[model samples]
Target: MIDVVVIGGGPAGMSAALVAGRGKKQVILIDEEKPRNAVTHETHAFLTRDGTKPEVFREKGRRDLLKYPTISIKNSKVLSIEKKAEDTFEITTESGDIINAKNIVLATGVTETLPNVKGIENYYGSSIFSCPFCDGWEMKDRPLILIAESVQALHVLKLLKNWTDNLIVTTNGNKIFDTDQKKMLEINNIRLIEERIIELKGIDGELQSIFFESGEKINRSGGFCTTVLDNRLPFIAQLGIKVNEAGFVIADVMGHTNIKGIYAAGEITGPSQLIVSASQGHMAGAGIIADSCEEAFQSIQK
Candidate 1:
């Protein structure tokens, strides 16, 4: 049995595997190669990897991780996971292979649900994005739109204000915000348009304008959108791991979930900066090692 099986090979998973291997634990990293940031041209705010392509960072991480003989990576998807016994988990892959590990780390990030508007898909990650901290600098001083269908719209609007003063919030026909929230946005000079977005006008994955169903067109350079994220796998539900209201895994500071022998990090736990997710992975790895050591010591005493 492996010491730890990390699902997902993104930054968080890679970091976890690296740390676990360094801790003298046998590790297996499984990834389907469909990183959430695959469409992003560049990743920002990462110390040395700022402005680096997402794929390039993953390539470097993979190369470095391979240097550890105790860590192995597989290009496959986890189909299911089951508790075989106390302190052990059995995982089944899409290829029908079964693997058992003492602990599991779920770094399976979320997939974004884009606006139903036409042409938005082509511009996602290029001109349209979700995280202001990640892509806001590139779109600074430009006319932007905050496309949201829930209270998250207010949060996105507040953050985008730092990047550009010229901004509009497209409610996309949802009026979920309360009166006070509406007043707060108005007082801040952020226009809220409760119109359904019909389409996006763009050229070759670069957004230019938003066309609303009310015959209104908002010309925008780029903007942020709130996405409805669904967990990539039902593992959280099947394994009875507690999740937040937002459908994210609930874990402690060190990435310990309510379910023993299971941990989670990255976007699966909560929305975080890339560097923050990597740091969380390192902490989770350390926690796993600490827990294992305690278990071993207790067994020896018995």
Candidate 2:
């Protein structure tokens, strides 16, 4: 049986597999190649790898793992994972391959539900973005819009003040803000538009203007948004893993979930950046190694 099976080959999975492999563990990193960051053009704030494209970052990460012979990367979709035994799991892939491993690590990230406005998908990751820290610098000093659909909108509005002063906050027709929040926006000179968005007019994914159902139009260069996020995995309850109130896995500092012999890292565990996910993966990998070694040692004493 393999020592570790890491699901989702983004930064977290790749980094986890690297650590496990370097520790002489037989690690297999499985990926479907659908990364959440696939929409973004460039990744920022990762030391020594800042501004690298998402795909290129993963490619370079894979190349670094080639030095470890025990690490194997597989580009296949996992259909399901079943706990065959107390310390063993059977992972079934869409291609009908079954991988049995002593430990499983879930690095599966969250899935973003963009705003319902028309043409948002085309503009996402280009002229529009979700994370202010990631894409804010490029949009500095430009006229921008902040589109939010939930209570998180208030936090997003406050966080974005660092990037640009000229800002407009819209609720897309939902009155999610309280009196205090509304007052805060007004005090900051941030126009609050509660009108429903009809469409986003742009050229080649570059945002130009926002149209409301009231026939009002606002011209803007680019903007930011905070949309709904959901955990992408379907087997959390089946595997007895605990999720927090935010629908994210409840992993500790070392990425240890409530389930034994199973671990998690990255956005699935909580909010994260590329570098943070990679760091979490490394810690989880180390935790798995330490636990597995203790188990092996105990077996010999029995």
Candidate 3:
């Protein structure tokens, strides 16, 4: 059996496999190569790597891991994971390969559902985005639109103010905000639109304008959205893993889940930056090393 199997090839899984491989343990990092960040043009907030393209960052990360002889990366999707016994798991891949591992690290991240607006996919990660901190600077001081349908969007509007005062927020015909929130937007000079969006006009992934059902057209160079997150995992249901109310896995500081020999890290635990996810993977790898060493020591004592 492999010493460790990491079920995501993102920064967290790769980092965990790297550390474990450096500890002289055999590791397999499996990934489907379909990453959420592939939609974005650039990534931000990682020192020395800020503004780097997502695919470039991933390629560089793979290069670093290639130096370790004990580490292997499998470019395939994991179809299912079955706990065969204590400290043993059988992972079935889409390619019909079954990999057995003594330890498992789940770095599977969450997926975001952009607001249900036509042509939104074209502008996402380009002229429109979800995270402000990631793309706010590039869109600073431009006429921006916020397509949000929830009350929580009020907070996002406040964050956008730091980048531009020329802001317009629309609820897509959903009046989900309280009266106080409406008053707050009015006081801040943020125009609020409560009509349904008819269409988003853009060219070459660049957002040019938004057409509302009320026959109103607003020109916006770039903007942001408050997207819904989906973090559900098939393994969680099969293995009965512990998760918080928000669908995030409940793991310790070292990334140990409630189940023995199973660990979790990265965005599945919570929304985290790239560096933070990598750091969590490192800790989880260290935890695996400690556990393996202790088990070996106990066997030697016997």
Candidate 4:
């Protein structure tokens, strides 16, 4: 059986496999290539990789990971997982192959629900984005709009203020905030619009204006929107793992889940920076190795 099986080939999964492989453990990295940020043109805030295209960074990461002979990557999706024994996990792939590993690392990320505004998908990755730290620099010094549909909208709008001065918040007809929230935003010169957005007018994936259902139009260069996020896979529920209210896997500091022999990292655990997610993967991998070693040593003593 393989020592470790990492699902999802993003930065977190790759980082975990590398660490496990370096520890002399046989590791398998499984990925489907359906990345949450696949639509994004550039990735930012990652030290030494800032402003680099997401694809470029991933390609380079794959090449570097190939240096470890003990690590292998499979271009396949995990359809389901079953616990074959106390210490072995049987992961079934979409291609019908079954992989047995002593431990499993779930790095499956979150999926974003884009607004139903017409023509929004065309500019989703370019002119419209989610993370402010990732795309704020590219949108600096421009007329920007914050489209919020949840309580998190207020936080996102506050963060966007750091990059652009001319900013407006579109609640999209949802009143999820309280009076204090409205007062704070008004004090900051951020206009709050509760009108429902009907459409996004843009050209060549560059957003130009937001059209409201009330026949009102606001011209803006670009904007960020809040989204309700869901896990890409329901494997957490299938494995009987506990997830936080935010729908993220509940993991300890070492990435250990409530289930035995199973751990998780990356966006599956929570929303974190690229570097932070990678670091968590490294820690989880090392923790798994240590636990396995301890088990073997105890058995020998017995």
Best by TM-score: 2
| lDDT, residue 243, candidate 1 | 91
| Clash totals in order | 0, 0, 0, 0
> How much lDDT does candidate 1 score?
0.88
In the range 3-56, model 3's lDDT, one tens digit per residue, is 999999888898899988999999999998877688988889888899999999
Q: Which stretches of candidate 3 lie over 4 Å from their true place?
A: none
lDDT of 1 by residue, 122-209 (tens): 8889998999999999999989888887787777888899999998888888887889988998898988898888888988888888
Clashing residue pairs, backbone N/CA/C < 3 A, model 2 = none
Local distance difference test scores for all models: 0.88, 0.89, 0.90, 0.87
TM-score of 1: 0.95
Angstrom error of the Cα, residue 249, model 4: value is 0.5
How far in Å is the alpha carbon of 201 misplaced in model 1?
0.7
Runs in model 4 deviating more than 4 A are none
Q: How far off is residue 175 in model 3, in Å?
A: 1.5
lDDT by residue (tens digit), candidate 2, 18-47: 998998999999999999989888998899
